[model samples]
Target: MAVSQSSVFSESARGDAALSQINITPLIDVMLVLLIIFMVISPVVGLNLDARLPQANREATAPTVPPLQLVAQADGRYRLDGVVHGLDTLRSALVQSAANDPERVLMVSASADADYQAFANALATAEASGIRQIAHGQ
Candidate 1:
């Protein structure tokens, strides 16, 4: 008669050797499941970004434009800062000077006997040529 070998393994030194090699397939599968879970949830949950424009409290600290002194004489002649200017000369001067800074304040000082039309013409001319900030006085 012949003796046969048994396939059963007891919890002893023989089994310990078999258990030494860890089965990491389950750990890797769990990590892959978690990665897929995060990837699927990311699209549903988006990031928020907000940006606002300048408010009423905000102030601009830019260089100011120089003032323009325009005197409308009673005799229908114009003078720019005390310099005598003929009708045509005055218009050209106003346009060139104002071109340097359209925001420059224009102070129109009309004499007591000056025609209202004369002053109006100066103002209209300045305004038509894109000159804003016109101030009138004596």
Candidate 2:
């Protein structure tokens, strides 16, 4: 009779081969637990304090003086208080008005067909004449 030897290790059990796939089961479990905790605690953590905000006065005071109207025409002229004036005359008039009342507001309106240069010139003249407050009108 002859005695035979058998090996217990298999060829697939070799340690030289590295793991190619990653296991995400633990990561998914942790993420689900965190999501559940947040959902359960979010309502308890919210603030429900009652706040009293200060109310503003709704009454509006009327202006002491009416605003001066300046309209820019398409023909490169300006209408100040319904009187047409050239650029030089407009500058002089604006300067006079500004001297009279420095707080007076000038409301500028441009005609639909008015040149952009005319509008810009009107603004520039108003600023040069020491007018502080200027407003735009439709």
Candidate 3:
């Protein structure tokens, strides 16, 4: 009887080749089971509470005093509430208005062809007259 060592070694090497490669069937099954468990429990984990938000009042309150409108014209004159006023007159009026309510807003507007100097003078006058809130308009 002749014993071949090469044949025995070859059979063992083939068995090791199969063992070296990883089998992923059990890993895939475990992942799918975890995914299903998370999907079923996700909805129940959220809080379900009834909340009551405060509603706004439907009543409309009117303003006590109307806003002052000032317009700078191209002729170097200012218009206060549609009345044209000279530089000195505009200053006096602004001072009187500020005396009434210093917190009131003065809306200053200029025409497309209005003088830039006039607009600047109007803003300066308002500031000098103690009018704190000044708004620009088209």
Candidate 4:
């Protein structure tokens, strides 16, 4: 039996050329798996709170007493009923007002460009000064 060197060399070259071609089937399979995983997990990540809708009631009554207005300025100053006050005297002023009219509602009217901390401070002062009801005004 005689084996030709040319034939052996040709077979080796064919095998090497086959290896040079890229195999994309595995890469496509991995990409499809990642896409499916993201599609399944995306909705669950945003599912946070489950809220109950309130039933409509037509017989609700309105409040009788007028609300006290407290305005928050852009410069961190507060105005309660046309009197401007700073943070140092805010709590005392709220307490005095509450003493006069215990049933009056405390309304905070924050400026359009006021900082969030200013509004929060006004709310805290009202609550800490023994005011029962508090609300935000336009």
Task: Give the per-residue lDDT digits (tens) of candidate 1, residues 1-138.
Answer: 553345343446578888898999999999999999999999878966577776774466667755788887878888788888867788788888778877788888777788888888777776776767888855
Candidate 3 similarity to native, TM-score: 0.58
My TM-score estimates for the predictions, one after another, are 0.51, 0.56, 0.58, 0.53
Where does the lowest 10-residue lDDT sum fall in candidate 1?
Answer: 2-11
Error of 3 at 3 (Å): 32
Error of 4 at 56 (Å): 20
Question: What pairs collide in candidate 3?
Answer: none
lDDT of 3 by residue, 2-85 (tens): 869999999999999999999999999999999999999999888687898888776765465767999999988899988889
Residue 48 accuracy (lDDT) in model 3: 81
lDDT of each: 0.78, 0.90, 0.89, 0.91
Better-scoring candidate (TM-score), 1 or 2: 2
TM-score of 4: 0.53
Window of ten residues with lowest summed lDDT in model 3: 57-66
Total colliding residue pairs, candidate 2:
0
Candidate 4 wrong stretches, greater than 4 Å? 1-63
Q: Best by TM-score, which number?
A: 3
The digit string of per-residue lDDT tens for model 2 on 32-129 reads 99999999999988968789998876677556798999999999999999999999999999999999999999999899999899999999999999
Model with the higher TM-score, candidate 1 or 4? 4
Off by over 4 Å in 2: 1-63
Please rank every candidate by TM-score, starting with the best.
3, 2, 4, 1
